[model samples]
Target: MRVLLVEDNGDFALPCRQLLAALRGVQVVQTAASAQEACDWLRANPGGWDLVVVDLFLGQGHGFTVLRECAGRPPLQRAVVLSAYADETARQYARKAGADAFFSKTNEMDALLAYCLQLAGEVDGANR
Candidate 1:
């Protein structure tokens, strides 16, 4: 599975990468630190990613913009919001903007990984 990870914190990236590495069938992972970069990457590689994991507060832009950019993606393409600000309001907004799931960085890391693994399994199964 190909993933585009949109996160700004260098501190968080390494841990996230390590977690992803433990998952089977996660072939390629890309990172973007800003909303503009995420949008540009999506445009440049249209229908190229299997999953997108985004943070709400970016160094340059918000994750909502990235969600909007992914609104028209294929059914197999998934977008999820993993943010520190995972309040009810933020969750609702993320869902409205087109996120498949919203997880809190403070407490829901395991859930996020499980969801990713589920998606990866589905993709791998379908490809076979």
Candidate 2:
């Protein structure tokens, strides 16, 4: 699975990149630090990404804007929110903004990994 990871923090992005790279058949094709950059990249490369993992808070923009940018993507292309501010309100907004799933960085990291593994066909959804 080709992934576009939208995260500004090097601390989180580096570890997330390493983990995703360790997964079979999964590769993080690119990284964007802000919503505008991510949107521009997506526009420049239509159908170029299979998954976009976005953090709700970016250095230059909010992830909701990124989600909005990806709202019209094809069904095969998924946009998931990975954030520290993953409260109920945030989740509801994320869903409305076109996120396929929302996972909290502090509480649902395992679920995020499982979701990635399942998407990569490395594991079954039932297992996740």
Candidate 2: tens digits of C-alpha lDDT, residues 1-128: 88999999999999998888898878899999988999999989887888899999898998989888887787668899999998999999999999999999998988988898888773233235
**Model 2 bad stretches (over 4 Å):** 122-128
Task: State residue 19's C-alpha deviation in candidate 2, in Å.
Answer: 0.7
Cα lDDT of candidate 2 equals 0.88
Best by lDDT: 1
What are the per-residue Cα lDDT tens digits for candidate 1 across 11-127?
997788778777887855688999999999999998689999999999899999999999989888999999999999999999999999999999999998899889999888887
Pairs in steric clash, model 1: none
TM-score for candidate 2, residues paired by index: 0.92
Show where candidate 1 strays beyond 4 Å: none
lDDT values for all models = 0.91, 0.88
In candidate 1, residue 50 scores what lDDT?
Answer: 96
Give the local distance difference test score of model 1: 0.91
